[model samples]
Target: MEEWVIGPRLYNCYKCGNMICRHDDIVSKTFQEDRRLITGLHTVADVYCCDCGERLGWRYIKAYEEMYKYKEGKIVLEKFKLANENNW
Candidate 1:
């Protein structure tokens, strides 16, 4: 089992005033790992707009699992990555 964490900031759609929702955010890389070493880190930010019925940005991270549930009764999975301290 992998432990996951979300930022204190809640993401909202820049194009719309819809509040972004997430089901899961999994981090495969630890805080100390080098991001460059990981090829194609799976970072997804699965989201959708109820009013416009548009698919928002998804897959923003290099290696993460993000799930979203929309008000219109829809579920999506998003993945993303975090900045690697080792890379700095």
Candidate 2:
């Protein structure tokens, strides 16, 4: 549940031709590249691959009010699940 799959991409690490699964904390690290508070709260980050240090993607951080939209899709996706979806 850590990595968001049903929302806009937070990571697009295809340079290594690899794909990351849910909540892949070990694969990437995001560092804020630019942040502006006076502009009504916004943040930009650079996501890098943890393995080969490749640039993955850029992330736009948002607060709860605006950020909740990104999560709404996940909640809806939860309604469709296999019986053994968590068997791993």
Of the candidates shown, which would achieve the greatest TM-score relative to the real structure? Answer: 2
Candidate 1 per-residue lDDT over residues 54-86, each given as its tens digit: 565343333332332111222232223212222
Candidate 1 similarity to native, TM-score? 0.27
| Cα lDDT for residue 12, candidate 1 | 42
- Clashes by residue pair, model 2: 3-23
- lDDT of candidate 2 over 3-88, digit per residue (tens): 84454232223445344334443232332232343334544455555655665544545434564435222211111111122233
Cα RMSD for predicted model 2:
13.7
**Where's the lowest-lDDT run of ten residues in candidate 1?**
65-74
Q: Which stretches of candidate 2 lie over 4 Å from their true place?
A: 1-12, 22-41, 63-88
Candidate 1 residue 45 Cα shift, in angstroms, is 13
Worst 10 residues of 2 by lDDT: 75-84
